[model samples]
Target: MLKYKLVSRANPRKRNEKQFYAQLTGVQTIKRCDFLSLLEKRSSMSSADVKSFLDALEFELMHRLANGISIRLGDLGSFRATIRSVGAVNKKDYDQRKYIKGVNVRFRPSAKWMREKSKTGELISFETVGKA
Candidate 1:
């Protein structure tokens, strides 16, 4: 279950009006070690082995992304790297060195994953806990 509280704040861009939204009462964080322990029981590999495997996977993912490649993760999703650049006046003036502004990574989930997540029969609930 997800618990949240309604929060009211003055609209910075608008005058004499307040904006309301639901904010999470608390957040739970899961760490690498905790995840490794859970994975260890589900796999034949030990925690240390799982940790090493995850490290290698992350390294390879970053390496491939840096080389302008997209990697597919079967049913989970795929990761892609993209860059945004400033506009140039002409084709002759368009140079990556001067026009490139930022680089970012994007993930797209698979259709199966999205379909399963959209099913209302799944055991998921949201609770409102008043104001924050």
Candidate 2:
């Protein structure tokens, strides 16, 4: 379940006009150690083993992404490095310092994640927790 609060936000175009919207409130974050411990219990491997594997996986992902490779991680998702830059008229006129801003990783959720249904409503449900 997700907890949300009603927030009054002003419109960017019209600052005087405001409307209420649901904003995510107090989302809990699971740290690396805590997540590793949970994974350790679910698998036969120890926490240290899981941590080592995760470290190696991170390295591999970074290396592959830097080399313009998109990786599909089973049912979880696929990740690819995307360029956030300005357009250039010609390839020869394109300059990395001016045209290329930065690179960002993009994740596309799997079909299972996109279209999961449960007996109780949806896979994820939200609850209102008053105004913000």
Candidate 3:
């Protein structure tokens, strides 16, 4: 049976709107727990710790991008700053001069994720009740 069906069976009235929304949004909402509780759950660390780690990683990537460096996250893709020259046209001789003042950015994903995503074929569609 589908996961949603199981959930609906367990709660016929579906009183948990928050849980339903979280499921639809594809985001997990973990409850707050102590370090010992996390260890007991075999998670290695608390949810707060995991969130902090992700924030730190994002900050580091932003810093690298600011310094004009490309960051490649494994299984993700590649990010890099692209520098291009914009030319200025002179009305007198119609001569064009190129000026360079590049922009910094970041790229991630290492091709493996793309291959995996391609294997999924096409996406399934669903209908929304009140939307035409």
Off by over 4 Å in 3: 1-43, 83-85, 89-108, 122-132
lDDT per residue as tens, model 2, 1-132: 878999989988899999888988889999988988998999999888999998999999999999999999987789999999999999999999999899999999888776774335477788999856
Per-residue lDDT tens digits for candidate 1, residues 1-132, read 778998988888895799988788766889988988999999999888999999999999999999999999998899999999989989998889999998999999888767775356354457899756
Off by over 4 Å in 2: 8-20, 88-92, 117-122
Per-residue lDDT over 33-71 for candidate 3, one digit per residue giving the tens place of the 0 to 100 score? 454356456767666666676668879977887777788
Best by TM-score, which number? 2
lDDT for every model? 0.87, 0.89, 0.54
Clash number for each model = 0, 0, 10
Stretches of model 1 off by over 4 angstroms after superposition: 1-28, 121-125, 128-132
Assess every candidate by TM-score: 0.71, 0.77, 0.43
By descending lDDT, how would the candidates be arranged? 2, 1, 3
- Cα RMSDs, all models: 3.6, 3.1, 13.9
lDDT of 2 at 23: 89
Error of 1 at 66 (Å): 1.1
In angstroms, give how far residue 16 of model 1 lies from its true place: 12
